[model samples]
Target: MANKYKCINEFVVDSYDENEQVEENDFFIVEVGSIWELQDESYLSDVRLMDNEGRWLEIAQSHLVEDFVKLN
Candidate 1:
């Protein structure tokens, strides 16, 4: 399919707001698949969430970058 890549999964990075607008500096949990991309392998993302709009972002780190394997 020529548009196979275009069918990639999409997500709306929306921050938890009750009465006000949320900024990008605000932290949030990306709820999607069971597996999540951790920042520097510390179970977090360097970038944060913001606004009521869909600020969707995809995270992918190469395994060669660092050994983020959790030790038992």
Candidate 2:
């Protein structure tokens, strides 16, 4: 079973290139899941978000702070 969530805040995410470099054109808003993988370090760990497309993203804890929530 997967968790569910929604975007409470708007932020931009950048993608990486073949050389592991950040691409400016890859910048996008996080329309991913509100449901996330729980972390032991809530404030110091990166949260995992599963998008509507079944893609998973590991974002910094700061990025998701007060921006995402876990569904029952």
> How far in Å is the alpha carbon of 41 misplaced in model 2?
14
Q: Please give the TM-score that candidate 1 achieves against the real structure.
A: 0.20
Write down the lDDT of every candidate, Cα atoms only: 0.32, 0.57
Tens-place lDDT per residue, model 1, 1-72, is 111111123343435345435555675553322232322222234322221344323333342123223212
Give candidate 1 regions above 4 Å deviation.
1-14, 34-72
Please tell me which predicted candidate would have the highest lDDT against the true structure. 2
**TM-score winner among the candidates?**
2
The per-prediction tally of clashing pairs is 1, 4
What C-alpha lDDT, on a 0 to 100 scale, does residue 46 get in candidate 1? 39
Q: Please give the RMSD of candidate 2 to the true structure.
A: 4.8
